[model samples]
Target: MPKIKDKAIIIGVDAVLPALLAQGVSPHFITSIDPQKLTYEKIADSADQIKDVSLIAAPYVTPEVHKIFPASNIFWTFSTKSIESWINSMLEGKILTSGASTCAHLNLTAAIMMGCSPIIYIGQDLAFPEYRDHAAGVVLSDPDQIKKELGVTNQNTVWLDGVSGGKVPSTRGFLSMRNHLEHIMASNPGPHYINATEGGAHIAGTEVLPLQEVIDRYCSETIEFPSRLHTALQDSNLSNTKKLLSGLNKALNDTKSLSKTVNKYDKLIHSILHYIRSENNNGAARSVSDLPILLQNKISNAESLEKKMDNRKHLYIWQILGEGTMEDVKKSECSLHEITILAKQPENFMLSFTKNLERLLSLNKARKNILAMFQHRLLHIINFHRKEKIILKKIEQKKNMEQNLFELAQFYFETGNLVLAQPVLEKLLALNPDSAEVLFYSGAIAARQSKFEESEGYFQKAQEADTAMSKRVLEFRRGLGGIYFDLAGIQEDKIYSNLSRKMLFKGIRYCSNHPKIKQEIIYLAESDLTRIKSALESGTINDVETILTVWHKGLEENKNLAPCITDDQIAGFHRHYGELLLKKGDLDGALKSMQAALKFTPDNPDLYATAAELFFAMQDFTNGITHLNKAVELDRSYAILWENMGDHLLQTGEINDAIAAYEQGFIAIPENINLLKKIGDCYLENGQLEAAREAYKIVKEKYELAQPPRT
Candidate 1:
C-alpha cells in the first residue's frame, strides 16, 4: 500500500467506479456527456460509489444533484471553439476535464492540472474488438461480409451526426475521440501516463494489466456491504417479497453486494437454459446470413446522404457569392447566417459584386431567372460527372494494359490496398492465356480463399508457360517457380515439401545469372526448410545444411548483391545465420559472422545501437562506443541511439562528457534508461551526491515503475 500522495490519479469511466471505490482510491473521474441526452442526475446517481466526480458537460443537472455537488467539483468544457469563453471561465484549475477524443487525452489534461506524478488509466476500452456502431443499442456485425455484399469498400463504419445525440451513431464519434486523445498526449508533456488494462487497442508507452487480474482486484478489494436502507427494511418485518425488493434497491448502492444478486439469479439462469433447450434452436443461425444485406442498405443510405449534403454545401457557397454585393459583404461579418441570407437571393449579391450585372439583367426574363437560381448548381453537377467519367475511363485503360501489367499490379499490391490489384490481375490474365506471372499471383489470391484446385491449376499452367517461353526462358521459369512455391505455402498435401524443393531447384537453375532472382530463390528455400524440420521428424539435416552452405558460398563470391540489398533484409539474414550457428555450438563462428554482417552495414542505426550487447558479451567497451558513435552519426533521429552511446561512455569512465552526452540524448529521446543511469553515474563521479540522487530518483519514479512499451 503506497501513500495516497505518492500514488497516481487513475482516470476511468463507469466500469471502474466499484473497483476504485473498493481500494479507497479517491481518483478524479472525468465524465463524458452526450449533449442530447444530458442528464446530470442520472450520471451522479450511477457513480454514487465514488467520493468525487468531475463533470465536463453535466447535461443540466437537477436542483437536488446540483446542491449535492460543490461548485468546484464540476467544470464546463467543450472541444469546439464556439464555447471558448465559457469553458475558460468555468474550467480553470479543474483536476479533471473531458476532451473530444479518447479519455486518455482527457486523463492527460486532468493529470497536468493536478500536477500528478503519473496518470494511470483503468477501464480504458477505446474501441470494440469487432466492428460495432457506437450507439447505445446498435448491434454488432461482420464488416467484411457487409463490404462484399455492398460491392464497395468502407473503412469507417460509423456516421456520427454533428447534431444533438438524436442521430443514429456512427464511427465519427469514436475516430474524433481517438484523434483528440492522440493530439493532447502529443502536445502536452508532464505526468507520465500508463494504461493498466489489456482488453483494448494498444497505446504506446503504456503498461497493460491482464483483464482477469483487474476483475479479481475489483472483486477482492472493493467494499460492498449491505446499504442502510436494506437494514431498516429488514428490521421492519416486511413481507418476504417486499424484503427482497428492498434488498435489491439497497444493493444498488453497495458495489460488492451485486455479487449476491448475481448468485440469486442462478435459478433463473437454469430456467432460461431449460426453455432454450425446449424451444427450437435453428432460428438464430438462419437469420445470421441476412445481416450483411441489411448492413449494405444502411451503408448505401448513409453514402447517399453524404453526397446530398456535399451538393447542398457547394451550391450554397456559389449562391452566397453570386448574390452578395462587394461592399455589403465586406461590411458584414462572415458567418453562416449571413451566407444563408445571400444564398436565397443570388441576384441581389450579383448586382453589386459583378461588373456584368447590367448585361445579366438585359437577358430574357425567364432565362435570367433560371440562370440566377440554378445555373451554378447545374454546372457543378456536370463537372462532378465529367470527373467520374474520366476515372472510369482510366480504370478501363488500366484493365487493358498488356506488357506493363505486372509492374502496375505490383505497385498496387505493395501498397496494402489489394482491391484494385486483384481486379488488375484478373484483367491481365484474360489478355495473356499463358502468363506465368499473372497465373502465379492469381493463384496466391485463390489460395487465401481456400480454392486449392484453382491454385493448383494456375501453378500447372505457369509450369507449361515456362516451358514454351523460349525467348524469355529465365523470367518465365522464375515466375513458374514462384507459383509452385506459393502453392507449397498454401497446400497441406503430402507432396508439398517435394514440390517446394523441386520449385526451389528449378528457380536456382534458371536464375544462376540474375543475382536478385537467386537471392529470392535462396530466401524462399530457407523459409521452406524451417517448416520442413518442424513437420517431418525424419527429414535429413544435410538437406538444410546444404542450403545454408550454398547461401554462404554465394554471398562470399558475390559483392554486388550484398551492397544492393536492403538493410532490413541484410539484418534478417545475419540474425538467422547467427541463430543457426549458435544452435551448432559455434559461438565464435556466430560472433564473427554477425560482426561481418554488421561491418557491411556499419552505418545502420538499429544495428549500431544493439552492438553494445554483442560487445558486452565479448567484454569490450572500446569497440562498443566506436560503433555507437557511428550509429548516432548515421541516424541521429533514432530515440535509442543516444541512450546506448550514453551507456558506453559511462562504462569507459568518461565522467563529464558522459553526463553532457546523456543529457543531450535524453532531451532527444525521453524515458531512456541508459541515458538516465549514465547521467546519474556521471554526477556521482563528479562528487555531486545530491544531483546524482535526484537524477536516480527521477529515473526510478518515471521509468522503473512505468508500464512496458507496447506494440
Candidate 2:
C-alpha cells in the first residue's frame, strides 16, 4: 500500500502459509483466490493485529469473507472489467490486468501496480506435496463428498518435481496452476521473484530462498501502508465511476441491438427448418444450397451486432452470463457450409438437411435464453444505478444446448462417445474443408467406428493438407499402419491382403521411428507369415522378397530411431528361425541359426543361457559351462543366471563351486524360495548347521509374510 519498492511476499497456496507465519514473516499483502480456504479465516483474524498488512480480495470472494475483514484494511483487485463493473460501478473502467488466470496472478499484478518490487512468493507450492492434496490446516473434502458434490472424484495424482529432485505425487490442477504462474512470471520480467515456498516443483526465474532470508535481505524495519492504500482506493473509485457510467450506457444500447439481432436469427432458423420439413426431395436438395443465400442477411446482421458488442460485453455481465450463445452463432456458419455440401449429394440431402435444421433450432433456442439473460442483467444494473426496485420478468427454464461445436465434439471424442462426435466432426469439416485439425479428428472418429477405408482416406487427406509434414505426418502414418494391420487381419482375398501388406510396409517406411508402429509391423508380418508364404509359393505375390528387403531398409534408415532395435530383437528373429528349422529336423541349420543369434546378443544373459542349453543338448559341456559363466558374469543381478551356473557346477560334481554359485543366487534374490532351499541344502551337506539354520529361517519368514494374515 505504501508503494513498498523493496519487497512484498504474495501468499496464495495454503500449504506454505502456516510455515511462513510460524517463521514470523508478515506478508505485505495476503491474497485469497477461494474464500473457502482455511487460511482466509486465519488471515482475517490476524489482519487487525498485523500492522500495515492489507487484505486483497479477488472478485470470487463471498459476502462472509467481506464481513470478516475491516473495509479500510481491504483493497479490492478486479480480475476483469466485467467483474469490476458488476461489483461497483465506481470501480469500473479501471485498467484490469490479467494474471495468467489465477488469484495468485491477481495478487502479483496488484503488488506490481502498487509499486512493490522484488516480490517474494510464499505458500505458492502449486503442487500436492508428500501425497497430501493440501497442507495441514487447509480444508479439504473427502473423496466421497467430492464425488457427490462435483459428480466426479477430485482424487487424482500426477508426478511433479519434489524437493529431493525426483518425481513426487501431485494433482493435475496444481500442475496447471504452476504452469500458469510460470507463464505469468515469464511475461512480467522486471520484478525479481524469490520463491520462498521451499518445496514443490521448481519454477524458473524465481530464486529459491528461506522466507526469513528473503525478508532480511529486502524488507525495511517499518513503513506506513494503510493510509496510502486507503487514499489510493478513494482516488481510483472517483476516477473509475465516471468512466464506468459512460461504458454502462453504451453496453445497454449494445445489448438492445444484440437482442434484436438474436430474435432475427431465431425467425430465420425457424423459417429454414419449416421449409426443409415441407419441401419434397428435389426442392429440399435445392433449398439446402439456397438456404445460406436466404439467411445471409440475418447471418451478416448477427456478425455486425457481435462485432459492436465485442469489448463492450466485458464492461457488464459477460463473465456472469458466460460467453452466451456467440459460440453457437459462429458454428451456424459451419452448418451453412455443411448444407452446401449436402446439396451436391442428392442421395442423403434431406437427412443431412433435416439434421442441420435441428442443430439450427437448438442453437436458436439457446441464443434466446442467452440474450434474455443479458437483457435482464443489463436492466438490473441500470435499476441499481437509478436506485429503483423493479420486479424483473423471469425467463423459462434454461435448456442445456450445445454451444461450442469443437469443444463438444472434443469432449465426446475424449469420453469415447464416437457416435456423438462424428456428426459434430462432419459439421467442423464443412466449416473448414482444408483444416488439418478437423481432418485429424475426422480420421480418429472413422477409426473408432471401424470404418477403416474412411479412416484411411481421412488420414491421407490430413497428411496431404499438411504437405510440409511439419505437424501430423508421423501420426497420420501411424494411423495408416494401424488401419492396414486391421484390414490385413479381416480381409480373406489374397489381392486385398497384398494391398494391405504393401500399405503397411509403406506406413512402416514413413513411421519406422514410432515403437508402436514398428511393433504393429512386426506383429502383422509374423501373424500373416503363413499366408504370405502361400501367396509367394503360388506366385500371387511376386515381390515378396523385395517388400521384406524394403521393410528392413526402412528400419535401418530411420534417423529418429534411437537404438530401439535391441540386440535381443535381432536374436529373437534368429531364435524363431532356429525353432522352425529344429521342427524340420535340421539340427545343423538350427545350431547355425542359434549361434548367429548369440553373435548379435553376446552380452544378453537370457540369450547366453539359451545358448548354454543348446550346447548341453548337443552334448558339448565345455561350451555349456563357458556360456553359463558368461551369463552369470554379464548380469550378476539376475538370479536365474546364477541358478543356471549353480546347476551346471553341481552337474560337473564341483560341490564347493555349486555352493558358492547358489549363495550368489540367494544374494541376488533373497526372496527366491528355491534358491534359499538350495543354499540350505548345500550348507547342510557341508555340515555347517548354523548357516543351514540361517537360510531356512529366512525362507520361513518370507513364506509366512507372503501368506495372508489369518482371515
Candidate 3:
C-alpha cells in the first residue's frame, strides 16, 4: 500500500474546527488561544483535542515551566497575543518551530522564528461581502516537511473592490498595517506564499488560483457523486433523461404504444431537441442553441437502421435491450445471448451526451462570472447618467423663464410702453447682455422716442456687447438699414434711403467675409431683398446658388451635430425635406422621409398631416387613415387634422366616421364658415336629413346677420 503523505495545519478563530475535522486532521496536536479570558478554563472547553489544559500563574513562562525537553515531538504552546513575540525571542537561540501570528507583523515574526518555506494560506476571507464565519474546507500540510515549515496565517481583512462585497479597511488601522507589510516584503522578499482559497484579496506575498477551480476542488468535492447525479437527473435542462423516462412510462402504460418501437426513438430525439430550443430561446442564452446537429442526425439514422434490422429475434432483442447492437450478432446468429455484446455503443452515445451537458454547465458558470463583473460596472454608469440629467433639467428651466422675461419686455416696447419696458430690459440685460435681440429692441425704442444721444449710445453698446451678433454683424446692419429705409419713406428723404442702401451693401460685404455665418444671414437677406426690390436692381442681390453654397458651408461645420441642433429645428428640417420630395412627385421617397421625420417629430401635427397626404396620394387609404388619426391624437386643437380625418374617411366610404370627424372639426373652429358648410355637406352625404337641415339653418342665419340691414 502507498504511504498516505497528505497532512495539514489549522489556524483561525473559533470557527476553524469544522473544516479541520472534515479534512481528516488529527485531534491530538491542535492548539487554540483565548485572549478575551484570563484563565485556561475559558478555552479548554472549546479546544476539541485537549484532555486537560493548565494556565501559567504568571505573565510569562520559562522554558523549564513549559516542560520543553529535547525529546518533545510536538510543542502545543498556548498563549494569546504574546505567542509570536516569545517565538521571535526564542529564534535568537537558533530554535525553530511552527506557530501562527496574531497580526501581519506578528505573522512575519513567527515565520522568521521558524525559518518556514512555502506558506499555503486558507480561511483568510476577512474582506468577504458577508460574514462567512468559516469556509467549509481545509488546508492540507505535507507531513514530510512538518519539521522544516512554519504555521499558516490568516491575513485577509481589508478589500479594494467594495462593489464585489469586499470590506473597506479603515485608513488609520488596516491600511497602515497593509502598508507596513508591503514595506517588509519589499525589504526581505524570501518566504513564498500561495492562496488556497479565494474569497479574500491578495496580500503582499500570495497569489490566488482560478476561483471556480478552487470552489470545485475544495467546496464541491465534499458532495458525493451520487448526490450530484441525482440532482442532475432532476434538472429540467437534461431533456434526454426526461424523454427516456417518458418513453418508458408510455411503453409501460400501453403495451402496444407506438413510442416503444425502435423507429420512434428518432421522433423522441427530434421532439426533445425542439422542446429544449423553445426553453433555451425563452431566455437570452444563445449558447444553449449551439448543440451539434451530428448527434441528432445520428439518433435519426439509428432509428431507421433499427427499423430495417427486422426478424422476430431482432424485435424481441430490441424490446428487451435499448438502441445498441453488435455487427457480428446482427449479421450471424440470431441468439439473445450474442445480442448482449451489442450494448457497447451505448457508452459512446452516453459520452457524447454527457459532453453536451458539461458544456452547458461550463457556459452557465462563465455567464455568472460575466454578470458579476457587469453588475459592478453598470452601477457607476447609471449613477453618472442620472446626475447629468438632473443638472441639464435645472439649466433648461432657468433658460425658459429667462426667455419668457425677454418676450414680455418686447411686448411692452412694441406697444410704446417705455417706462414699463425700461425696467424689464435693464433686468434682462443684467442676466444676458449679449442677447442681440434684446439689445436691438432697446436700441430701436431709444431711437423712436427721439433720445438721439441715448439711441446712438445704445446702438454702439449693442454692437460691442453682442457676442452672438458679431458672428452675424452684417445681418443686424441689414436690419438697421431696413429701418432707415422705412424712416426715409416716412420723411421723403433721399439721403436716408441712400444711407440705408449703403448700410445694406456694407452689411452684405461684412457677412460674406465670414462664410460660416452666411446661412442664417442669407435667409434673412432673402426676405429683406424682396421687401427692397423696387429700390434696387435684381442682379445687385446674390443668386440662389450663393445661398445654397452658404447652406452647404453650415452643414459642413459638424457631421455629428444632432445635439447642437435644437430638437424642434431638427424635426422641422426633416418635415421640410419630406415636403420637398412630395412636391417633386417622388411619393416613395416622400413617405420614407416622412417616416424618418415622424421618428423625431411624433407629436408634430403638421408633419403628420403631410405624411397622411402623401400616403393618400399613393392610394394607401389604410395608412392615410392611421396617420390622420395619429395627427388628431397629438393635437386636438388642430381643426385641420380633424378635417383631414373627415376627408380620408369619406374617401374610404365610411360616411358615419366621416360625419363624426367633420362635426369634431366644426366644434373646434366654429367661426370657420367653410367648416360649417363642410359639416352640412357631411350630414347630407350621411343621409341625416334633419341634421343637415339644422346645420344649413345655422349657416344661413349667420350669413343673413352679416349682410346689410338697410335693404
Candidate 4:
C-alpha cells in the first residue's frame, strides 16, 4: 500500500460539510462515515464531479447503500481484536484500531493509519451552529419537530466556543466528540491536527484555520497520488471469503452442540412440571425434598453449555460473519447473565428456575436459526465468487429444510426485502401446505403489500391449519384482525369494521394472558372507541350499546385470564368506562365505577381528578373538594389540577386557600389567559383591589397581543 504523507480530509456529515465543499479543498481522499448521507443524490453528484477524490467508507455500510455507491472503498474497523487480526491476516494489511463508539473515531484512526501528516478536519462541527444540526443539501429532520418530540426547549442549551471566540449554543453530544478528538490529538504527537471547520466547537490541541487558507498552504503543488484501493479490494474479497466460510463451519458445529444441550434442559423442565402436577394429587413433601437436587443438576448443565459458547471465538463469530454487531453480542451475554442470576435466587426457586429454562430455550432456538441463516448466506457468497450453482441446487433438493428456509425468509422479510422473501415462503408452502408458520408469514407479506384479500385468504388458511391453539396460531389470529381493520379503513364499510372487531375479540379471548397480545388488543379497542365517538358526534352511527358491550367483554376476558395485568391499566380502563357511562346519563353507575378505579390506583392524580368530577356531578361538593385537594397535592405541576382545586376551594368559602391555589396554577402556566383571569377574580373577591387591577392589566396586554394587527 502507498503511504499518505500529505494532508487528508476526514469528511464528517455535520452541518459544516457544505462550507468545506465550497472552499474547494482538494485532499488526496475523502473519508466518509455515513454512507447514506454521502450517497444522497446531490452529495454524490458533487463528489463525482470532483476528480481524483477517492471515497473510503466504514464496513457498517448496508447492502442498499453499497448498490448506490459501488465504487466507494470499504475498510474493516472491527470492534474485537480477534476479528481484526483474522481479517488483516487474510488481506495482508495492517490492522487499524477502531475508534471507541462513533464513526468520527474510526475516521481519525483511518487517517492516522495512512500516516497522514498535518491532517485537516472538515465538517467536524460537533455542535449545532445557530440551531442548524446539519449542512445545506443534506436531508435531516426539522429541528423544531425534534424539539417538540423530545419535549425540549431552547433553554436546554450547552455552551461551546464560538467561531469568533465567544460562547455559543451546543449540545452534550458535540462536547463529548470534541473531547474525544482532543484526547486523540494529544496522545499522537507526530502529526499536526488542524480543524478547518469555520463554525463548531473548538478542540484544545488543534489549530483553527479557514479551509481556503489550509488548501493554499498544503496544496501548493500537484503531486501524483498512487492507487492501491483496487488491489486492497481484491485481496479482501479472496481472504475474507475463506475466513467467513471457516467461521460459519465452526458456528454450525457449536450450534449443533448447543441444540442438544437445550433439548436436555427441555426434558428436565418437563420432568419438573410433571412432578409438580403429580405432587398436588399425592404427597408434596417427597417432591419438595428432591426439588433442590433437580434444580442444581439443571443449572449445572446450563452453566456448562454457557461457558463453552462464551469463548471469544464463538462470541465474535457473528461480527466476523457480518451478521451482527459487537453490541448485539454483548446484549445476548448480558441477558444470559441476568437469567442465571434469577435462577440462583433461593425463594420461589421453581418459578425462577422455570423462567430461566424458558429463556435459555428461546435463546438456543434463536441461535440455531441464526446459524442456519449464516450458512445460507455464506454459501451464496461462495457461489458468487466461484461462479458455481451447487448450493442453490442443494437447497432446492434437500428434504426437511423447512426450518432453514423459514429462518432465511424471515431474515429477508425483517430486512425489508420482501421481493426476495416471497419466493422462499412460496417454496416452503409447496413443501408443507398445512404449516401454520409458513401460511402466517405469507399473510404478513401480503398485508404489507396492501393485498388485503389475498392476505385474508392466507390468514384464514393458517387459522384452520393451526388446530393446536399454539402461540403462532394466536398471533396469526391477531394479524387477521389487523388485516380486517386495514380493509375497513380503506373501504369504510360497516361489514368489514364489524368483522375486524369480532376477530380481535376472538384473538383476545384465547391469548389474554400474553402481555404483548393484551397490549395490542387494548390499542385496537381504544382506536375503535375513538372512531365510534367520532361517528356518534357526526350522527353517522348510534348503536353505542353494541360497541360498549364488545369493549367490556374484551376487558373482562383480560381480567379473568391473568392477575399480572398492572393496576394502572385496570384503573385506566375503569376511568374511561366510567366516562362513557356518564355520557349515557347513568350518574350512580358512573360514580361507582370511578370510585372502584380509585381503589385500584389511589396514588394516581388523574384518577383522583376524574373522581372529583364524578362527585361534583352527584352534587356532593364536600367529597369533590376532598378529591381535588388530593389531586393537587399529588401533582403540583399540573396546572389544570390546581385550577380545579381553586374552584372547589372557592365554593367551600376558603377564599385565602383559593387564592393560593390560583397563584400556584399561574406559576405552572404563566401564559394561560384563563388562569390569569381566575387569579384576578380570586383577588377581587378577597378585597385586594390593587392586586386585582394589576392582574387585569396583564390579561389585557396578553389579549391585545393575541389579536391580529390592523391592516
TM per candidate:
0.25, 0.43, 0.20, 0.45
Which pairs clash in the backbone of model 4?
15-135
Global lDDT scores for all candidate models: 0.47, 0.58, 0.45, 0.59
Off by over 4 Å in 4: 1-53, 81-93, 100-103, 141-156, 226-244, 256-359, 362-711
- Residues 172-226, candidate 3, lDDT per residue (tens digit)? 3444555555565565567665566555544656556544444444443232333
- lDDT score of residue 511 within candidate 2: 51
Give the poorly placed runs of model 2, Cα more than 4 Å off.
1-28, 34-94, 141-156, 163-167, 234-237, 275-322, 326-337, 346-355, 388-711
Stretches of candidate 1 off by over 4 Å are 1-8, 14-27, 38-44, 47-72, 75-83, 86-104, 130-173, 205-711
lDDT of 2 by residue, 532-609 (tens): 456546755433433333333333343332143456554555555555556566767667767767777776787676
- Name the lDDT value of residue 303 in candidate 1: 44
Give lDDT: candidate 4, residue 684: 92
C-alpha lDDT of candidate 4 relative to the true structure = 0.59
- Identify the leading candidate in terms of TM-score: 4
- Top-down TM-score ranking: 4, 2, 1, 3
Q: lDDT for model 3, on a 0 to 1 scale?
A: 0.45
Residue lDDT tens for model 1, 1-711: 113312323444422333445556544544443332212223332333445444433323232233322222454444433223232423342223444433345456756665664455544545443322122211111233333333224455553322222222234446566556656666666556555543444445554555344344433433222232245435753334333334333322232232222223333333333433454632242222322454335434434533542354234322323333333433343343454465456444322222222222222232224334443443443444454445556556765457556665665444433434567788788888778877766654443323445655776676677754333444544564454344334343432233243333333433344544455555554464454355335544333443344445435544434443455455545644554676676656666666766766665676665554466456676776666666667776664655555567678887775776688678766657657877887899889999999999988888756868779
Model 3 residue runs over 4 Å out of place are 1-15, 27-35, 38-43, 46-92, 95-115, 132-184, 210-711
RMSD of 1: 31.5
Candidate scoring better on lDDT of 2 and 3:
2
